[model samples]
Target: MADLTTTLCGIRMANPLVLASGVLGTTRAILTRAARAGAGAVTMKSISLEPRDGHPNPTILTFEAGVINAVGYSNPGVEEALAEFADLGDVPSPVIASVVGRNAEEFARVAERMARLPVAAIELPLSCPHTPGYGTLAGQSTPEATREITRAVRAVTAKPIFVKVSPNAQALGEIAAAAEQAGASAITAVNSMGPGMVINIEARRPVLAFKMGGVTGAALRPVALRCVYDIYRTVRIPVIGTGGVATGRHAIEMLMAGATAVGVGSAVAGGGVEVFARIAAEMAEWMDRNGVARVEELIGAAHR
Candidate 1:
């Protein structure tokens, strides 16, 4: 059988399929469920220093190409998250804690707290496009901001930091390189793109209460692949390609594009948590048929 096992910053994974942040990662039970459902690793939803109500009702909308969500970083706060994920020993797969903040100080503070947990790593999502005080809207997408935030967090914890960058940034490669220089262990390339909107048409207004949200699913794969390819060339650190991955072929494409691992989020809405196992199995089958011996062999194949 083709070997699917891989490592990201020294953390071993049974496969490369990771459950992306913000999709069914709100609770420990769901995280564990995803792990048991076949996810090689699971990331919790973005947690903040304080609780947020998030956007009102119409936070999520589904279109033909993908999903658009402006959940507004709603979470019970880091305190609650600490309580929720305090014990991860029961989870079969490694847990990655995703943290968000309005600035480098907040990001560092939150990282300091979450680092105390037994998580496999800490993911800094500096790319969310929908929220006002966080992510791209807050100016966290720039190379300078990426460096400052990554450096601040690095000073507080020894845990591996995975900086998640925005797909919308034109200087995507530079931003990733900045993170690598600031002590980031890996780069999670391309968060959802566009705070794009969908109109209700009949109602004559936008569907989401926030009016705009990040785009994900099939529509984002190409852009994500390109971002990963660019970042892979710009930085020596591993890149976790995240955007619109849905199937085995997409996973393979991401690997060839230089992703050390693949992240799945919007697809879970359609395929359920079991999508992880399905994609991994499909990847194994494709590798077997193509005579690819191991998953690692495919990483950066396009660059070669």
Candidate 2:
């Protein structure tokens, strides 16, 4: 079998497949289950300073195009999350604590708290489309805002910082480059795209509770690939390419597009946690069949 191990910013992964934030990542049991299921790592759902119930019912919709959701970044707050993290003792895979904040100082506070956990690194969800006054607002508004958040978080933690940026950004490359300049250790390119809407023709209403949600799954693969390609060229840090990865081929494509790791979210919604091992198996099989010796050989291969 082809070797699947890869390293990002000094942390080593058994494979490149990471169970992306969201999608069954809310609790410690589920997160640990994913790691036990063969995920090289798992990112917890975004946590904030206070608990949030998020939007009402019908926050998610699934159709032929893909899954669209406005889950509103619901979470039990950082203190509760810290408790959850503390309960998960000796999980086999690395855990990346995903943090969301309304401002730079809040981001720093959360980062400091998460740094006390057993996590391997911290990930900042800078581009969540459904949540207002956070995520994309703090991320895509300006490169300066992105830089400030990154700097503050970096200052508080010795753990590697991974800033997840949005594909909806006006200056995607500039924002990514700014995060790099501000001391980010890695970049997770392209969160869900758009407050794209779907309507209930009979009810004459929006399908989602929020009226709009971020599009995910296969439909987002192309856009995410392009975002990773652009950010990869703009920044030297490792990139976690994520958006619509559903299969092994898609993971390979992301790596070829310059991802040091691949984040699988929507696919898990379909295949459950086993998607992590499945994707890894598929990637290794493909590499062996293609005469490739290891997964790292494919990283940025398409850039040429």
> Which is the leading candidate under lDDT?
1
CA lDDT, every model vs. true structure: 0.93, 0.88
- Which window of 10 residues has the lowest lDDT sum in candidate 2? 133-142
Per-residue C-alpha lDDT of model 2 across residues 1-304, encoded as one tens digit per residue: 8999999888889999888888778988888899889888889998998888998979888878678999998899998988888866857888999998899999898889988999889998788988877887444346888899999998999899999888888899999999999999999987899879999899999978888899998889999999999988999999999988988899999999999999989887788888889998899899999999888899999998
Candidate 2 at 302: error in angstroms? 0.6
lDDT of 1: 0.93
Candidate 1 lowest-lDDT run of ten:
57-66
> In lDDT terms, how accurate is model 2?
0.88
Instruction: Estimate the Cα RMSD of every predicted model relative to the unseen true structure.
Output: 0.7, 1.1
Task: Show the colliding residue pairs in model 1.
Answer: none
